[model samples]
Target: MKKIALILLVFMASAACKTNPFTGKKMLNFYGNSQIFPTAFAQYDQFLNQNKVVETGKDAQMITNVGQRIASAAERWLSANGYPGYLKDYKWEYNLVQDETVNAWCMPGGKIVFYTGILPITQTETGVAVVMGHEVAHALADHGAQRMSAGTLQQLGAVAGNVAIKDERTRNTFNQAYGLGSTVGVMLPFSRSHETEADRIGLQIMAIAGYNPDEAANLWRRMKAKSGGQAPPEFMSTHPSNDTRINNLTAWAPMARQEAAKFGVTSFK
Candidate 1:
């Protein structure tokens, strides 16, 4: 049984490896991009049809404008990094919904929805760019794909472990091991890395889009205040803590500004 378990683990580890595009880190991602992209596109369309998508107007126009700038920045960054036409599969669209929820999200295929309540906090076009760039960075970095891959491995490991164990005590031990390995070795660090990468890429994108990267720090301050000090610690949540995020963004802003200078955006106001 021990030999069989060890062999299975070895196979799983060998079969699940991938490399993160931005960080160049070796990771375990079992899902293929070809499989995930089409499904994400279909889901995005379905969501647009079902939701109250805002039409042409001030708020709607602002969303679309900021989204386009960010999308252009992403395309430029990818192309410069030798991934030309990387965004060909993306059908980007942005909308502001009438809801009061202070929430926003960028879906897998570049669909973005910004709830009206978030606008008050965003305050200006640059602030909106900060939030939109961060959300868009998540999609570009393929964090969703990584998360799905991690979930698949966790499920498969549990099933294999259950099949290998005979006694209830051994089964429980196997289950615990599977859970700990999946959560600690796979999920937690991956999530934190994604958050940090998103902040880095998002700052660059916003700066290239002609929005001041400094706004990212202020945006997180607003997010923290809006949360009323009610969020879980950085380790316990998918997002970094407010202070950590703000500090990281502050440190990265000058670098982003430097990168933007190469793109003819010397000043962002």
Candidate 2:
């Protein structure tokens, strides 16, 4: 029985192995792009058809323009870095939805939705680019896949630990303890890393798209100001603290600008 179980575990692990493109990290991923992308695309289309998608105005046009530029930048970077046709499956679409929530997100398969309420804080095309770039970076980096991989590992670890323990009551207790430890120690840090990486990559993408990387810092400042001191600390949340994020952006901006220079981005002020 134990031999059979071990064989099964090895097969499962082998099936789940994947290599991350951006970080080059070997990870366990049960789902592939072929499975994830189609689901995301369908969900995105359904969302647009159900929502009040803004159209026929300057604001709408601006959203589309910024999205297009970022998408172009992503394609260029991917191809130059040896991921030719990386975005061939992407059916990119951008929409501004009429909402009061100051939030935005880009789903996998290149669907982006920006809430109108965020525009006031974004304040300019550069600001919008910063936000859009970050969201797009998340998709481009396959952060969603990373997240799912982490979750699967956690579940498998829990099950293996429980099996080793043997006693039902003790196994339950161990599982509970493991859950708490993983949430605080592994999950939170993993989420924070993704956020920081997104910020760095986003800055570069925005610069490559001909938007000023410097605007990234200012955009965070505006986001902080708009929050009115209500956000949680960086350690406990998925996002970095405003100050920490801004400082990191400031440090990374020069590098992004230099990268853009190679692509003829001369004036990023």
Top candidate on TM-score is 2
Q: Under the 3 Å rule for N, CA and C atoms, how many clashes does model 2 have?
A: 0
**Reference-based TM-score of each model:** 0.88, 0.90
Clashing pairs in 2: none
The global C-alpha lDDT for each of the candidates, from Candidate 1 onward, is 0.82, 0.84
Give stretches of model 1 more than 4 Å off.
Answer: 1-19
* lDDT at residue 121 of model 1 (Cα atoms): 88
For model 2, the superposed segments whose C-alpha errors exceed 4 Å read: 1-30
Q: Identify the candidate with maximal lDDT.
A: 2
lDDT of 2 by residue, 1-269 (tens): 44555565667667866655556766556666787889998898899889999986999999999999998988888888788877777788899999999999987777899999999989999999999999988888777777887787677677667667878999889988999899888888888888898898889999999999988999889888988878776667877888888999999999999988888887863
RMSD of 2: 2.4
**Candidate 2 local distance difference test against the native:** 0.84
